[model samples]
Target: MTPIRHNHSDGDAVLDAVRDCVLAVGVRRTTMTDVARRAGVSRMTLYRRWPDVRSLVGDLMTREWVAAATDAMPERRPGTLTRDLIADGLVAGVAAFRAHPLFHKIVDVDPELLLPYVLDRRGASQEALLALLADVLREGHADGSVRQGHVERQARALLLIVQSFALSLRTMTDADDTELNGDAFLAELRGILERTLTP
Candidate 1:
């Protein structure tokens, strides 16, 4: 695979294609050739850009997850507290992720694809979210609305909490039991985030 000589501008089309492919038939069944055919690009072109299906799917996940996180962020008003914004954003972010079709497809059909990210290493999307979180935490610190601490560390901790709720909350949720349903746990998450960020 000629990994270093591809055009980045073609990423949108490629990502869109891979997203459709994966959604139609989970990552395990998706092939590099399928992505190329869906993207209307040559197989050689795809090979030049991505070594395999997993890498292509990785980029697609990064794109879609970042979009969800960005959309979940509340607009900052003059009197809005930064910590409150963060708390709201974190809760909203988890909700968005849980609602994402791509996330659901991967979790339902290709959960093994996530094991490496969950147990072994952070993915590009996680790093992007962490940077976004750190920047917002810095803003909160500047406004005296968040607890003082290393921004990266705080972001990482918050991410750990978010990941649990976003990825695995359903496993413990009891839709038949109102006390432990998804919404209840989301409320708990919001409370935990607020307490963690309170100065």
Candidate 2:
């Protein structure tokens, strides 16, 4: 059995090192030794805290990504989900996706890194998004801007489209077509929602 090391600061330093390695070499290639060297710790120290790269990656996703998703949600306005989705929220989401180096590198090096977060539909990020959508939908319906009957389904559908686009964009090699025209997507989405959802 491997002996456990109980220094909180060392554990944090090792995780941070792992995150850096992930960005530099990606998840699959980032070994415990690499993280330990980067963190100025021993491999035994890292292994004591996290058994393997898989466990470390899973913790990183759950801790970092979940917090990011939850913290990034814009404040809800009851009658303005469409405006929020089209104008500020969607734009912010796109910008965030573009700016996230770790996310980009993960997909670039190993697309499967995205699988648990995207394809499975049960990741921390997805759950956070669903909760946000539910709140927005409830607000929209309460203010009579969104129709009540199909609120949940429509919200999920809208989220799915955005998620799909994001995933596709990550894998795209052509910048010309791959670049997200935020305004265009939002305009089209708003038009569809207005036509279908307005009473």
Candidate 2 residue-wise lDDT, 101-192, digit = tens: 77678777877877766655576556656666676667667767666766567667766766665566435435565436454554564465
My TM-score estimates for the predictions, one after another, are: 0.93, 0.67
Question: How do the residues 91-120 of candidate 1 rate in per-residue lDDT, one tens digit apiece?
Answer: 998999999999999999999999999999
- lDDT accuracy of residue 194 in candidate 2: 60
The CA root-mean-square deviation of candidate 1, after full C-alpha superposition on the true structure, stands at 5.2
Against the true structure, what is every candidate's RMSD?
A: 5.2, 7.3
Candidate 2: segments with Cα more than 4 A from true spot: 1-15, 36-50, 67-72, 75-87, 116-121, 150-155, 170-183, 186-199
